[model samples]
Target: MASKCGLLLFVATIQVLIVAAAVFNGIRSGYTKVPTGQFNSNIDQILLGQNSIERILWDDFQKTPELTAFFVTENPVKTIANGAFQRTPKLERLGLRGCQLTGFPNLVYVHGSLIELHMSNNLITKFTREDVHGFTKLQMLDLSRNPIASFPDMRYILPSLKTFNMQGIGFNCCLPLYQLKHPVLVIDAAPCAYPDHITDRLCLLESRFRKFRWNHRLEIKAGYSSSLGGTACQEGIFGPTCSH
Candidate 1:
């Protein structure tokens, strides 16, 4: 009996070790080659991982000013450093999955050009309306598998956003998605505790807006902004200097 028990234990330990080795090898095989000195000049898109030699190389970015897409996954990018993307003005698509980043990097320079942002499997907690208001042309946003608890009104901010992915984040309140006129595909409906209240508010808001002119309808929250017949003008959705 004792020999049989020992044999079973040894087999389980061997299985665990085999799984761990396989995972390690898989990660190693998935690494994309970082551009070398001469290879950096004309590259428009690059896949990066922890072993990327150019991770901290600023000159590489300067050489590739027209870089449009950047993907960094299955690794931890400790610091993106200020002005890292200052020269990549044409950057449109950015993916930072599994980068261990706590928040977004400073991409103020690329705000106007960025269209798709994928930050899945990071440690992000929140994304206020103001955080994304500047990306007017932004179309797709994937924040799946993050730790975000709540997000502000998406309609008032990302009016042009088409694909919004919030799967794997556990939210407790209903998102005000009615304000978005553009066709948007929302993934993962929020699991709210007060379903009745949320449903009633959405119903009332939608019904109230149906009576008003489309141009006159502004997204609003209670006691948050100046109301035209109890409908407050949505904030932070305007262009620079609130021109829009």
Candidate 2:
């Protein structure tokens, strides 16, 4: 009886390891070429995970030199294109939390004066050290709600970071989060927010579909995916930002 129990336990452990590896491999697949992004030359930024061409929005925004803060309420800003700062070089605060972003925005910087960046509540899944390495003066960053499998060492990358919020985040697998100081990152904290799989296999699915959008008409949670099947996934689809 003891031998049989041990054999079962070992098998379970192996299966768990296999899934974990797949999750990491998928997320790291985009890093094969060591992106010569902000880390190389006079660079600083990201964009929707897999999106390539830069899309612009709000043409009038190009002349707001005095605008200290940029925010969108119910409108839901999808991408913060490079033109967003063509005229305004000194943005002190940016609020994109709870918006519709599946990946990081490749930002071009004229100055690193941005002090507070609110990016929690979006569907951002992939993040790395280079993402924020250029935020030389960034003081606070909010990355909550997005189901990130694991966080890379953020100790020194953000030199001026005083507070980091990652509440309501996702996990690759089950986590013993009782020891976590920021209980807000708990997947079960909110009801009907993200689908059950978000908390179950967050990492495994994070990199699966890099380009996706939210269909407001559908009765589904904001970050929920339609591919999983159910009445809430009518528009499990995404293409160019304008295709919506």
lDDT (0-100) at residue 162 of candidate 2? 72
- In model 1, the clashing pairs are none
**Residue 112's lDDT in candidate 2:** 79
For residue 153, give model 1's deviation from the true position in Å.
1.3
Question: Pairing residues by index, what is the TM-score of model 1?
Answer: 0.59
Instruction: Report lDDT (CA) for all predictions.
Output: 0.57, 0.48
- In model 2, what lDDT does residue 13 have? 100
**Which tens-of-lDDT digit does each residue in 1-244 have in candidate 1?**
9999999999999988754442112224344334434334445676564443324334446767757877767666645666767788888988777766676666676789899998888888767776776888899988888887667657657667888877676554433433332245353433342333332112122422321122122233322322234443232332101111
- Model 2, global lDDT: 0.48
Q: Report lDDT (Cα) of residue 85, candidate 1.
A: 74
lDDT of 2 by residue, 79-165 (tens): 666565665566677666666687777554633777888888777879887677778788778887786665654656667877777
Top lDDT model: 1
